[model samples]
Target: MADVPALVLDFGGPVLLTPFEMAVREPEGVVRDLFLEQGPLATRQRPDPLWADLQEGRLSEREYWARKAQAWHEAGGSAPDVPVMFESLYSPPGPRMIRPQARALLADALAAGRRTAILTNDMRAFHTQDWIDGTEIIHTVDVMVDGSVEGVLKPDPELYRRLAQRLGVDFADMVFVDDQPHNIVGAEALGIPSVWLDVTDPDASFDRARTLMGLDEVVRDG
Candidate 1:
């Protein structure tokens, strides 16, 4: 098939380092210690039954974070809820929030004549308006479909269809990249090619996307 003419990216995992990765940077405190001791970071080293529960879909994303926030609050951490927890976790955001490959992929795709867009479920919900307005990827892309703003969430075919319409491309002409498997399945169900970003190895994930879009030569030559 011809190279997909447009690229759609999920904002959180694929573009930004996950909250698990950011937890290490959090100031030394009960919340940071708690996350490192019992959360996904710990799960990376050993089996965390709670992480397993999340992976098994027994806990929704909100519930998982809410549980953490509640635990942290009970432990004397400042954050008492999901939004507050995220704010504390992602403080002083700037270019550091973006993965380097995400910047290159977005720039290279646009340079190579592909429309680029971000389809995010939480940019607005989890981040402050000032942060959103100043984020590099928010301004770099040709289009941005924010689910929180639209009252829609991903893995919902309607959001995908809306992004395709906004990008002026058919589903088959776009390549969607996200770290979530369910989102990949949803895009693929509508004939949109997709890259499942491995949050553990984002470079490899971006390499897969660059290869799928045949962007290596274009970026190399330019």
Candidate 2:
């Protein structure tokens, strides 16, 4: 982690907070609850086949949703009302907060003259650039390698390498943090020191990350 010139952050669980992670943290509302409310058959609904294509920018957002609805019905579940589900599931009540510790860590890295980038397996079905653009976190980011835009996702070493190249940073000197163990292994395989963050335990994850980055302890609220 020495001589870390850049920090490559994962968007979902590591940087921008996600409901999936929150479900694990709070244990009150799980993702399956939504499906259960729809119908018992809804639980059998499989992932949309066009999901990857949609994320990779190969399919239009509208087409993805239509295909997604079709996928649900095909799986014996009543298709969700797209608008209602979108607001209830994707756009929850919260304005989605970034982990406070993550924000602090990025700020510290940037203040110390380190470059920061966001590398995420994303679905750009709707306009979310506003979230990133308007957030304070964007100020620290030097590049964002989104799967939808890049047509590549994490655990694909090529995506990480391409992101590194795009940021003009050597893989060896980049510090990456992802919540997925598979992604961590993938980055490490490329000789990049990567941290596995447990988003449910953000403070502990960031503490371990600070240790990996050769940084001293920091106090930040969740």
| Best by the TM-score measure | 1
Off by over 4 Å in 2: 21-32, 35-96, 123-127, 217-222
TM for every model, in the order presented, reads 0.88, 0.65
lDDT of 1 by residue, 1-222 (tens): 234568789998888777666666777776466665354345655555776687677875657767877887888767677777767766667877788898889888988878889999878877888777777678988899988899988889999988988888888888889977778888999998899987667889889889877898787787
In model 2, residue pairs whose N, Cα or C atoms come closer than 3 Å (at least 3 residues apart or on different chains), thus clashing, are 55-148
Give candidate 2's error at residue 82 in angstroms: 9.0
User: What's model 2's lDDT at 25?
Assistant: 41
- The lDDT values for all models are 0.79, 0.64
Candidate 2 per-residue lDDT, tens place, 52-149, comes to 46545577545755554454455543444444333334443233556778887888777667778988876343325554455566566888887777
User: Which runs in model 1 stand beyond 4 Å of their true positions?
Assistant: 1-3, 37-46
